[model samples]
Target chain A: MTERFDFEGNAWVLGDNIALDGELMELKYALARETDPEILRHQIFRGLDPTLAERIRPGDIVVTGRRFAHGNPHIQGLIGLRGAGVGLVCESIHSGSFRCAINAGLPFLPRCPGVTALVKPGDRLRVDFATGALQNVTRGERHQFDPLPAELRRIVSNGGWLPTFRQRLAQQN
Target chain B: MGQTLAQKILSRIVGRSVEIGEIIMPEAELVTVHDWYAANAARALDEVGVTELFDPARVMFTTDHEPVAVSPHAAERQQRVREIAARLGIGHFFDVGRGGQGHVFPVELGYIRPGMYIAGYDTHVTNFGAVGALGIAVLTEVSELMALGSVWQQVPQTVRINLHGQLPAGISIRDVAQKIIGELDPDLIDDAVVEFAGPGLRHIGIDGRFTLVNTPTELGARSAIVEPDEIVRAYLADRVDGPVELPRSDPDAPFRAVIEWDMALMEPQVAAPPRPDRVVGVSQVSGTRIDHAYIGSCASGMIEDMRETARFLKGRVIHPRVRLFVTPATNRVAAQMAEESLTGIIQASGAVLTPPGCGVCAGGRIGPVAPGEVSIGTGTRNDPGRLGAHDAQLYIASPATVAAAAITGEICDPRGLDPDLQPREAAHD
Candidate 1:
């Protein structure tokens, strides 16, 4: 199935480019060490806020900074965010992390710096990615963006080129 | 005025062309401010008449350079980022623990994408090129443009890095990056995009690509890119729709510089303090003692990194004098390491594994060394205050080298370890 990502239903509208405005919330270390002998051995991993993890649903849009997927480029982080049903619209991103997200099939909206200023976390938003216009369902705000080139929008809205191609194939079939 | 890629991308998000390096007007798309060089962007935005124009939805903030907030005043300065983000209606804020260094988290959340342009206060923002986007670090002029919804830019000349052979086992993506940076004069590719090509890239995972792409700034390049492949398709399948095809440079495309590297004969390279370009092989630093070791960050914080550490530390204890910390890049990587049983091997080796933030790479996030301390790890930017105090010295190395040093408390070749040693059983999910 070619999963498609559109800004449907209620979405928060941010008018400016406030893509990066969230709590740091680094995963908790499993253990505390003042001074440890082993340099390469230990059992600590990044932990996340269960609440935050659960708060996000699929298709939710995350507005963020340039290098959003900075550290590790862990597929887990991408999967967790994607599984929560959130899409991303940020200003910039790290290359490796971008690949991880794309490979994971996450819906990403790049160069949408105004998203942060246009929407709130819970504000209902509807995005016509084809037209690059996002409507804030909650605050009755309407924001227009330079719509993606029709082809690019198809690729993006259809969840990337593969899905878009599959959808095209289906139409032909 | 004709539009550049930056202007084109920005216009789609914002409604107009914003004056670059000028006072704000209101069409800015997304704005990012870091502790380092943030004042420049802030001042630029202010000068452009944008006291608070960022659309909270389009702003992302991170504290990297001096990981520790430094002075209470510095903490206050950092706090201002949140205040500004909130005041400007910014929705995403990565206060310390929430997001590790700026280069690591935003992309993990799926915010940054391909074919976009980004401006940050720091030089390293160019790391965004790995996913085929143009990441540029600019002064406040661009910040204000972000606030006003636009910035000016010229289409960058491009450079191509063609790989001809596979990397030898026990080698890492970091080595490739360091080797390239070391061999290529920093000035040759200045203000240009460096794209990765050839079959050699296939052996490298995304983490490896991050390592290579992260250091374009040091090379004086504008950005870095790796052509999208099936690996990208498979990775993106679960997130959005399905297989997607992204653009890659043409094989015969004009390039400002072209370099070919054979991965098979490549040796692990290290970037010594004070310059990433000062590269050397493991044989050169043999027996060089280290005080601290870290294995984390977007550059080296993946499952492959953990496995490499385990392979080096298998059935061995860390040197008594060294303090080694291993932080996975994210929760999933840590879980995967556990499942792969690499975590146990690492634990049995006596290293202290940390949580998934940007641990110790930028110094302030986890634990920074005191003055005169020396540490080796797979983190980025060994600048002053990069770890804790500005005087602390950091040596950037591969995960293998970092792990080997952690285990031996001295610089040691990771290849000395038994490569045939099998990893532990996979852990139950």
Candidate 2:
């Protein structure tokens, strides 16, 4: 189901997995294996574990490694995760990810340094999109970050353009 | 008190005593639409009971994103867009391959002009800034503005990036561009306008300038512009109604921030691994084998790209294992390359040249990375799930670098190749 983001104590370890927890079962697969030389050098970004999608839910955050936006900023990656109902929290962002998040209105939480070490695989982490903080229940650590300004936060939270547009329209009339 | 081009344009358009960082909302003169979102916006019009919101004459529409309706599901989506455009009274609808990408065709058709504020749903819509227009990417709030006939925007503070020194041999506009983005934090410039200036500005081509303006969305900048010069005038001369002079910034203009770069010392660089800003010289990542090397996209496909590809691949064949694809940004680019026999050199060297239409650059179609495979391309935006697989990697580079990578199956420097083969002349304007 769906869960609104709530801040909790930080005690989790982070690893890139493409699993989502929700009514819609989703799993992201790697295009190339990590061991392959071709995959190692030219593959988009290695920190992304495609399998993280299998267990993620609406409010859970994705804590990834450096260069989170390493490949093309295909809407499918963020859109698929969003469709499966998960909010993203990454350590760093790339130009392509920045474009995808803004254009499609996806909310991406960036600049959470050492976030991966603070959370574990399959760890239920709490993050507040409003204030830009992460809490790990398992590790008992708290990560702080700068929040998105109201306008940008509005675009990301409404699940990108469509919902954002709908919300803005409601406000006008 | 340095001023940016966006600041100058906003000042002229809004004509208010605006302070730095105060949002200045201007009346947009021309708004464009594609069958995808524009049609969606049109439907919203009917839902809101306001169908005649936008002037049909000023509004334009095109269908590029979903071409030929590969799947039945896709076909249905296309039908919906067409119905919306037809019902909303939009006149300029472009079919697959008929109209070029919205950004290129609008300027070609003389719809976009200098000193005008233009908005489109697509991010690359910023490409129009090359023609000296204040082109900004609009979100749904903007869609509401278009349907209701207005958009709200704060006049953002302006940032002037003084670009000086000629780009050195073996380096390209793309390399310099990535360096700039790498230098800035994405959050620092959100909702701001970025303008490029300085004497070295003359060395950049219009296509290259478009690359910089195009990705402002990534930098969190509200809009971006390059002060128009001979390069812009020459490009716009034949297309405009009269002798169109380029716009320049006032010497005494005010700016919120100013940064400078020495283009000469910049080397052939790559946005390595995961982030566009995680940039490093090709030497650092050299010998990193590549599985696929591609050249051509709206960002890098130009006459210069083809010439570079041919020059690099003249006597060399692509690495046996690395698959290569090249799609010219426009038919004009493709046709010119074919006429010059550059296409022959590219194909004979084992590279596949595909038809235009943003082919693989846009996801869900061609050139996506297969799981863990690595492919270096000239296209912009190397995010996860690009090139087909989330784990797939994409490296950004110039056309020459892309071609050289194809030959060696690694991220090799283009300058390291044969110096005897002269690169093609850079396009003026």
Candidate 3:
């Protein structure tokens, strides 16, 4: 049940204010209460880029500008992104979305002030979710940002909130 | 190095000094879940193999979302909710007819006190901030608090907003809230606790302050609180049994940013469809046709809003083309409306009175607008598909503005209506 703390992946860069409700995944899927990741993976970025989901490979990276996942804190997008086996590095993310990312077990670096300018689409990148070390292999660029708080990291690394809750129960018992 | 009100409350809870961005697990004074998420919370608790709550006395459940249980499925859900509450030994259960909206009634019942920290499953829990309480929207995380007794929270930086001057006649505090959110920089408010202060606050009453505190969550603020003042004290004096602790921020409190607003310059605002922040002066959208109008929600369903609507629609009727629905926030508000004859006046004016709950704002579970129809309301958000039909256009404004639109069948400036019947004392309500 251990998730990787560090990984290398192909980069997919996006702009700011990418909303979670309509742009990430269709709102209807979330309304329908679709939780199976395998079924949701195809809907990731389906609205913005119809073919992007098919193009995304496992262990890929999504580098976004300020206010990534800006709208309603629906976790369907995070669930789908996790299903696509990708991690995220954004200049900023709303607190609600940050919670959803952790709950969905999506590895992300939520604060990288100039990350969008440093990385380009299709670039090879390496990210350490534990240390917030981001390296752009294709461009020979490196940047560091504050990692997720240790308490929150434990939740994400434990594969989302449910497993963490189960562990808490076990500890109490 | 004075701490803001948020830090003060968190520090009191954690039994230690807390700084901004520091993660701390503080026991919640109250944990609330509504009918919409009650079953999911029960399932989560079951999956985690936890059968007991940390303290049943601190936990509350309310059936406000689907108050009437229109469908068989809804009725069955309510039945399961009752069973879950019974099984968990929930201390406070506000069934459909007992309590109104979970957000509004808690304040009316005096469960929310100054400096108290609450964790709620719904975003509008910020409504409790009207009395200086911090009610963070935990969403599905309420289950964790229910089982573990505490949830982790980062002490958020406070955005200090100083208000001055008096609002012009006919303009509601909702307009001031909308204008503030529309004008403030997103970076200043994003994930920050908005603290209301300055002289203008004295002019806003409890219900108006509720609208002020409730609106900022739509702008991504973690929570909003008004520094407890005489107004809060006078409101809670009779409602609460214990000596109220009114906390105030120090003169040198650390604030992420300070923005001062002159309420005199404020105008009636409408958040056009597709987003709540897409705000414009009412004159800009005047004459826009609307088929439906609503004057309720956690944001604007107070008795003050009811009185304001009654003032506008007193001897007149809503346009025949428009269907107006007025929902009081709680049973207390409904009763107050009845006592004041506001209900009869509104009903005589052709507006329908829905149950004293979320009404049409609960995803349009009741009185949904048809597809392609335009509507205006006093609800918190105007997001697409927010009122049932994805294609249906929705605009957000104050109850006075909605009533004005309901009478005119279009988005007209409320000030353009009868001058003698204007809501001059709405601020004092």
Candidate 4:
């Protein structure tokens, strides 16, 4: 992933079941047609907050409640998130979406206890996806999320599984 | 610690024993591509600067997603996909009409077997677990699987289900799935596997078991599976060569939770629109009216499902207000239903018969639910906007229940139907 391991950004805190499709990204765009991430950028979270696309600048953070990415694993949504340089700090993520995010190289922190409650909308926050250290500059607190497993971190470092896989096969030769 | 079925399967494929919750990479015996991913998977491999498959013979591709190419673009895509498959030396490409439904055909043709670890590009690949084979739904990372020709899976904790009693009339395995799902919330099954065991396995055969394993994802489980026995062995006798290895969990192997189903107390379960987990029995939903009803999909579109649906519509026509769509799960199922005149019965009863292959089940590209319409169908998932118009109210039910709804033009109980069509003999015997 070209994404940095640690980054500081404004938070867009959301509640539980904040979906990747139909909520964060419009379903018609994410699931049905376009695969280009740049086109996807104009649609992310516009369904939830009509002004989201313009407001969600590069290096922004989304701290959502449990079961993030609740619906189908239509993955182009994550592509949009990565395209806009958005980072995520969620209480949890669904399995399919988790895999999609890993492959798309979207930087996210999952299983972050007390993070959603401490962080408020528009609060400034810094997240280290590698170490699971989430710091809320507004509230002046730091919370430890569960760190990525060794294999997960490796995938994240190399811009997701496919690129890492490509590298591995190349090394073998 | 005694390892679970997942642990044991991973152990065999990796040539070493594994324990629960350990992440291990294992080479797959089979990895299939549906039409949805066939063209993309091929392009993705090329994008990553690769031209060769790890072992082409181990890979399979199918044309089930859009079995009948809907548009010129689709037909052209199909042609290009064929060319790509040939270029890659990919083995076992089940072309349109040949593949039937991607999920169901591999079982019928015998590429999936008990104890074999299979991987596919769709989430419903979990359907493979019905026959006791482990199917890992590689949703987005399929490119990784394509490039690597293997997969990494975290051995999930098993949720044990011990079934008892037979499925009562109006209570198909679909209802049993609901009964099991009623107890599980999304959070409970994040990375879990449901393993079915016990004496009740004698009754649920391949068809019922397929319906059983198909819906665990709605509850967030990674996959659901049944243990392989003589029935499974017999089903795969011709398809699988040599004596098959049916791995079993050690008796004392640990499970995260155990659920015992007393099928006698069960009734047809209905999931009202917008969600599959929000379930109720058929009686509670007796009077809910419907505008449309469906009886197919990879979920409930099968030989047994078609046979079960034929009983209610044998001589009775559906209500005039309802538009009934009955699709066979595969070309083979369509052929079987026609041979037995079951297709004739459904058609003569005022239902529009669609050809085999997932018609409206995949987001209504073929026959999406109409806006303001209320419907019931055997296809999985009633998530809002999943079937058709965002406001469409879609109910998910068993094929029998869907047929009953088709008959009355509303969500009526199949149990309230005339007794002759009911499965009283099987339930009471």
* Candidate whose lDDT is highest: 3
TM-score of 1: 0.61
Worst 10 residues of 4 chain B by lDDT: B420-429
Candidate 3's C-alpha runs over 4 A off are B419-429
Per-model TM against the reference: 0.61, 0.71, 0.97, 0.90
A28-128, model 3: which lDDT tens digit per residue? 88788887889999999988999999999988999999888888888889999988999999999977888889988889999999899998899999999
Each prediction's Cα lDDT score? 0.61, 0.65, 0.89, 0.81
Query: Top model by TM-score, which number?
Result: 3
Give per-residue CA lDDT, model 1, range B291-405, as digits (tens).
8888887678877788878877777888888888888776667778989998888888888877665677754566667778888888776755668776877788899888878
lDDT of predicted model 1: 0.61
lDDT, candidate 4, B229-345, per-residue tens: 888888888887888777888888888877777777556788876788888888887888888888888889999999988877877789899988887888878989999989888
Ranking by DockQ: 3, 4, 2, 1
Name every residue pair that clashes in candidate 4.
A1-A158, A1-A159, A24-A45
The RMSD of every model to the true structure, in order and in angstroms, is: 20.5, 8.6, 2.6, 3.5
DockQ of each model against the real complex? 0.01, 0.10, 0.75, 0.56
User: How many residue pairs of model 3 clash at the backbone?
Assistant: 0
Interface RMSD of each: 16.5, 5.5, 1.1, 1.7
- Over B1-429, each residue of candidate 2 has an lDDT whose tens digit, in order, gives 645566666677777555564534566676777655765676556666665655665566665554446778777877777676677666676666665556766765566666667877767777777677887766444456666555546566667788888877777787887778777865555556777777888888877777767665555566777877787778777777887756666777777677787786446878775555667878888887899877866567667777877887875789998988887766667778889998898889888877655656677365556888888887767766656787887787778778888887888877867444343321210
Please, what are the lDDT tens digits per residue for candidate 3 over residues B59-151? 999878879998999999999999999999999999988889899999999999999999989998999999999999997678899999887
Chain A TM value for model 2: 0.64
lDDT of candidate 4 at residue B304, scale 0 to 100: 92
